[model samples]
Target: MNKTLQTDLLEIESLLELVKKQGIEYLNKIDERKTSANVHKAELINLDSKGLGARNTLQLFNETFEPTIVSSSGPRFWGYVIGGSTPASIMGDWLATIYDQNPQAINGEGDISANIELETIQLILDLFNLPKSFVGGFVTGATMSNFTCLAVARQWFGKNYGKDFAKEGITEKINVLTATPHSSALKSLALLGIGSNNIIKVNTIEGNREAISIDDLESKIKTLNGQPFILISSAGTVNTVDFDNFNAIKKLKKKYNFWWHTDAAFGGFAACSDTYNHFVKDWGHSDSITIDCHKWLNVPYESAVFLIKEEHSSLQVESFQNSNAPYLGNPMENFNYLNFLPENSRRLKALPAWFSLRAYGKEGYKNIVENAIDLAKYFGSKIKESENFKLLAPVRLNNIVFNISNNRNKENIDSFLTQLNKTGKVFMTPTLYNDQKGIRVSFVNWRTTKNDIELVFKEMNRIINIIE
Candidate 1:
């Protein structure tokens, strides 16, 4: 064995202790860390013939890279709909890495870690109060979750015309109708060979709303002339957190033969709170739904799930089954994840979510989600009263999207956001909403509170005052 490897193996316990101490210190001071970093460049290091021991490598990382790390998982970092890791999730993540288990087949040669994944999915369903008819699996994140669901939808569409698209390729020009879909869904279409540009755009509700207009949707369906299609709806839009009228969509589903899918991502957390659950009412009626555990469930990165009704299990298998691998057994009789989702070899990605759900349970997540909604409303109220900014739309859920109060110039919006982010105390994202430049602030982190909101509000006021 190499000298460094031997040394690391001998001192593994001490090395882990050092790491645990450092992790605790960082978590202890996360609130004090900058939301944005001033450093942009780092010198690249070349590999040496001899590897550095783990302790020395840790020292090197602390000296060269640690200072540049930003507190993106901290409460004040609101640039995207990012969520901080809860203690329970971090515990699960560490265990997952240590175990290094691949949760694939149920009847595998190894232990059935996939049972943990299955149980975790059920926990998530319970958290959302969704029906047991929906079967789900974990994936990397929002994009892959959307891809997985849409892939099955694509197969269902092909089946409607008595063709197997997965085996023969997508010979049909598939129809996709959506109002204000996240870019990830469009990218998934491009990845699935369904041309992104080929989508039939549905009109959104008039006057500062991102939800689809029912009248426009039905009229667009009329143009389809009874052809089967895929309907991509948003459970929570990125810019305004706007939700489609699901009750109305449920009515349409009875009359139409199209497959329904929703990209709920972070917004699906609304189902956790009784006060906010109406935004996602009838959402379970969707043939498939995508929600990110990393976002609102407050798990680590690269975690999302796709819930598809059990009725379409055959389509899922047809779309993702690996027929070439005879050793994996039949895809139909002996079920496994390798023949289910996009990736063949997947880590026990559901472990973190499992720990988080078990740790918090339903009421715990309800409190986290409701608290975020309260903070978002508090922040939105401040924005509405501020003379320097005006809300582009009302705070319907946990996001605040706004524009310069008296200035419509794009440069002014850019300058304001730049100046605000430069404060390094808070961060927000710039967006284009309704053909106008805007800024978006989302609240999903568990640590965020009214204090954080007040701090950001004061920072915004100070920045605007200086600019004025």
Candidate 2:
């Protein structure tokens, strides 16, 4: 080994201790940390043949780059549906890196990490009150999860027409129907070689709502003339957190020949709360479902899962099978994750979720989901009461879509959001709802509380004054 490598190996314990202390300090003072970082241009450093040891490199990183790290994981960050990490999740994430196990096959030649992943998937299914008939696997995030599900949907569509799109190219136009899909889902279509513009728009429910209109959806299906299509439905929309009527969709599935996919993502957490679970009733009936562990399970980044019916296992294998590589063995016989999902090799991405599920069972998640919903309602109430702000939509679950009350102030929405984010006390993202400029404040973080809402309210008022 190199001299620096040898030294790092010798002082591994002390190095880990230093890192532990830093982590503790950050988590302890997360609330006080700035939600946004000041713009600073980093100076480029050239590599040298003589290397700095681990300790020296750590010091250099702290001095040059650490200050630029923003507290997006903090409670006041209400941007882009992000969530903070739980203690157990962080512990599991750390161990995942230390172990560095590549989870692939359950009973293969390597470690049993895939078995652990399968167990974690079962725990997730139970938490969501889903049936055991769905087989799930971890992916990078909701985008990849959507990609995996839709890829199989594509193959299934081809199979309906006596064609193999995976073996050959897309032989026919695949009809995809959706209302208010997340941008990530559309991006998945683009990545899957299915044109994003090809989606047939199903009208949303009448009056300020994002949910799909069942009548309009059925009408669109009628136009397809008994053709097999894919229906992409939203369980939780980004701006307003509106859920499509899953019960009605389930009814349509009996009559229409189409694959149902629900992008529940963070919204799937509604299953945890009795008060909110009604929003996603009968969601388990979806042919495939996408949920993000990082968004609501309080895990670290790059974690999401796609649950597809076990009956479609052959279609999934046909969609993602690595047939060229003989070493990988038969995709159908072994039942490996490599043939089931997009990626061939993935880390123990399920470990953090396993740790989180074990650490906090159904009751704990219920409390978390309920607390977030309550906080969103509280914040929405404040927005409604404010003279300067007005809600774009009712607080559906855990997202508040609001805008400046005065129509004349519409042009200032972007500037106001910029200044608000610059305050460093809170962060939110801007949106366009019903062709009007708006801002979205999502409450998915477990650490968010009534106190955080109060702090944000005061900060928003202060920023409003400065902007006005």
Candidate 3:
């Protein structure tokens, strides 16, 4: 054996000793960083440090690595509609990385991966009461999810209208109708040859579309004058926690033959709760839906779900979608996952979502969703009781859109947000609801306790009192 290659017993023992000691210590060091509150900030380290040994890397990790592991997992992180990750999900994520399963397309890896993805998709379909035949795929987050769904919509429309959007591209005359609160991803969809300027911004009631009166939708559709239409609705809007009038919009979809897409990135999963199911009820009929498992499901970063009303919607978009090389695509030809998504190689992030759903069961998910909704209501009620605060809209789903004061202008409104963020007692975001600036809070974390909301109010009162 070569001198360096043939492991001498002494050298092997030394290597093992280094690995065991350093590995154990490094893991403990990471764990400490995760469980601590000092993670509101972090430092960086040089990857190419000559002086750093294994001990030094561990030391550097200790000195630098700070976890963004949000208190969302803890009882006080009431910032966004983010879910605290479950232990089972974390373990599944680890296994996925170790195995490094890349199920971006269909036929790259083990059946277990694709099947896990299919099964997860099935569960979501069942959860949403969608058709069993609907096709679904795992994506990064809502943005990609929205892009995937809208891309399918574009493909479907282009195919139906005899336009080669996949090759010759959009006719430069296609139009998409959406609301003001439509997620920013819509802008990206517009960039995907859908034409941002072509989008017709409908007036919405409240922050969501549940209040979108049928009259407004009818009037808007009537004005279209035979233009191609792709109607986008929200299952749960980010601001105002409003769900677009899906029931009302469904009627227009059938009448106008428009591809109805729902961007329920954060809110779509809320259907897990019976109380909130009405928000996304009848979603089955929608041509496409975009959902995020990482938000309410608490899986991990970049776990997005895209569902299509018909099978092979992904395949239809295949003109622009990825196709595997003969060497890679031909052998394991049972199913090639790459055909569906824009990416060829992607992390098997679905495993964690599958594992999480299996571990939690439907009831477990329902309970968690219910808990978050209830907490939001509880917080909304608390805010309502305070004279210093104002309720901007009805507490619907899990978002509380309210203003700290009745001051309704551009200058004071901007000042209020800056003050609140600077205080850092609570991190809140502002939105435009009914053409007015409203502060919104999302109760997404399972760790968020009732006491946390109380803390938020106390802090808000302190800040408002000082500023007022």
Residues 1-468, model 2: lDDT tens digits: 898899999999999999999989999999999999978886696897889999998998899889988888889999988989999999899999999998988785767688889999999999999999999999999999999999999999999989999889898999999999999899999988898888999999999999999999999999999999999999988888899999999999999999999999989999999988999899999999999999988899989999999989888888887888433434446667878988877988899999999999999899989999999999999999998899999998999999888844667889989998988989999888999888999998999989989988988888777777
The number of the candidate with the highest TM-score is 2
- Weakest lDDT window of 10 consecutive positions for candidate 3: 30-39
Model 1, global lDDT = 0.90
Q: Lowest-lDDT window of 10 residues in candidate 2?
A: 325-334
TM-score, candidate number 2 = 0.97
Instruction: Give the candidates in order of TM-score, highest first.
Output: 2, 1, 3
Clashing residue pairs, candidate 2?
none
Query: Would you list the rank order by lDDT, best first?
Result: 2, 1, 3
TM-score for candidate 3, please give it.
Answer: 0.83
Q: Please give, for residues 1-468, the per-residue lDDT of candidate 1 as tens digits.
A: 887899899999999999999999989999899888776585696897787889999998998889888888899999779999999999999999999988886775885788899899889888988998887899999999999999999999999989999989999999999999999999999999998887999999998899999999999998999999999999999988999999999999999999999999989989998898999999999999999988999999989999999888888888887879533434446667877898988888899999989999999999999999899999999988888789889999889988888753435778788899987898899988878888999999999989998888888878776765
Comparing 2 and 3 on lDDT, the stronger one:
2
Tell me which of candidates 2 and 3 scores higher on TM-score.
2
Q: Residue by residue across 354-418, what tens digits does model 3's lDDT show?
A: 88888988898887788888998998888788777778778888888887655523346566666
lDDT value, candidate 2, whole model: 0.91
Give the higher-TM-score candidate: 1 or 3: 1
Clashes (candidate 1): 0
Error of 2 at 310 (Å): 0.2
Off by over 4 Å in 1: 42-44, 326-333, 407-410
